[model samples]
Target: MAKLLALFAAGPLAALAAEPATVAPLTNSGIAGQLVQLLLGLGLVIGLIFLLAWLMRRVQQIGPRGGQVIKLVASQSLGPRDRLVLVQVGTEQILLGLTPGQITPLHVLKEPVPLADAEVATPEFAQRLMELLGKDQKDKP
Candidate 1:
């Protein structure tokens, strides 16, 4: 058993000693290939980040802003008394559909009404809104 172990260790040492180191022929294209691969990977990552940033900016620019007055052009009532209001803001137009009791901004008036008044008198305003919705639904089909 001891002789077998000694032969096994000596066999690997002899094999390693017999193998000689050799160098392959230098190829200039190898460096260029690695450089091209690295550039492509960097460009792909940068392009993806740029696209994501552009999308976020587009999404943020779509919503309403403070101190901006929106004008109501027209409104239409859909089925089941659902109402839609068309308001023109800065350079864009928005459609707001209201229900029986919903909060909406009245921004297109020459004089601004206080928020307290709107909150204090809800029944009258809601009644008027319901009447408007009823009239609109009747006028359309």
Candidate 2:
């Protein structure tokens, strides 16, 4: 076991002793060239990061734009992690119950309301309250 340990230690030492030491002296031009390469590489990485960030911003601004049929009418927060959302698909309006884990359909309108007549964009608080009460009345006998 001692002989095996000595052999293992000697193997690395022998290899190191056998290796030729060829040290090239650093010149000013070689140093300058290396510095230029390093600067260019760093600049390329920074520029790529900036480009990706800009692309992400532009994508966020342009959000889901290709022939989108569903439009969000309104959203009300029920709790910290729960919400009621009114979404319009074509002419039909759907009430959705949203939670942290799942989305559920709370109600679906039988009579489809026209988007132009619905005043969905900027509905007054009184108007919206009346509409909700009217909808509740319709649901009951």
Candidate 3:
């Protein structure tokens, strides 16, 4: 009978009767802070990656095509029906021709002009060619 009374005295019901329930820890403000931080970090990283990709694409778009590009150095009008253009591309110089509806390659020069031989900032021939090309735009009508 004494043992039964001791067991009853030590019961969880008696403990609960003595003290109210203690509240649990708040737990990181209910996961909202962590979730927001995770989402913010993910967005930042993805935005940066997309920005880098867009920058690379813009850089590629502004530059020339891969391998080599041809440059026209000079040209001449030959006869009434033929037109000639002197072109220099990398290590070779070539003469291209236009005759009515047909196009032809006239010659390939042995020596190419060195980059130092011409001033890029003030190229008279190139300027004239650009003017001629601009004039062609008006003639199209």
Candidate 4:
């Protein structure tokens, strides 16, 4: 059985070895076409990667907004590790004080504050920058 299998395998191998092998000579046009094909394949892979990344970002952005029952309306830093966060639950807004040690409930608002009203206080850096810009404009001849 071993000899029979070996003979069968050698039969094809012997025929292939006896046959004259044809080697296609490389041409400039052939090489250029192969290079173009390689470049196109590389571009396709890169474009697919970018498309997946963009799809992931869009999916992540859409995921959070749709499923959120509780939303943070505003946040203010009281100290280095302490913060006041106002969150809207259903129609009620609750103010929470957060520290490194614990989270505390501060107050529940009777009327929901408009989102625009919450950002009324300008940041200190922004205020100072505006002041400097105003001074520069005033000094300009």
> Model 4, 1-141: lDDT tens per residue?
999999998999999999999998866678789999999999999999999999999988976677688988899999999999999998999999999999999999999998785345667887688787775323435
lDDT of 1 by residue, 1-141 (tens): 999999998999999889896878877778889999999999999999999999999998888656567655566777676777766665555556687888465344443322332233346676688687775323434
Candidate 2 residue lDDT tens string, 1-141: 999999998999999889997888876678789999999999999999999999999988797777689988778999999999989897789999999999999999897545564333434775678687776323434
Clash tally, candidates in order: 0, 0, 0, 0
Give a tens-digit lDDT track for model 3, residues 1-141: 999998987897788889977998876665888899899999999999999999999998886766557876776788998889877777788888988998888888787655554334546786678787776323433
Off by over 4 Å in 3: 1-68, 79-81, 113-141
By summed lDDT, the worst window of 10 consecutive residues in model 4 runs over: 132-141
- Candidate 1 segments exceeding 4 Å error: 24-27, 54-141
Error of 3 at 14 (Å): 91
Decreasing lDDT order of the candidates: 4, 2, 3, 1
| Candidate 3: residue 12 Cα off by (Å) | 86
lDDT computed for candidate 1: 0.70
C-alpha lDDT (0 to 100) for residue 112 of candidate 2: 54
User: Could you tell which candidate, 2 or 3, scores higher by lDDT?
Assistant: 2
- TM-score for candidate 3, please give it: 0.34
Model with the higher TM-score, candidate 1 or 2: 2
Name the 10 consecutive residues with the lowest summed lDDT in model 2: 113-122
Local distance difference test, each candidate: 0.70, 0.83, 0.78, 0.88
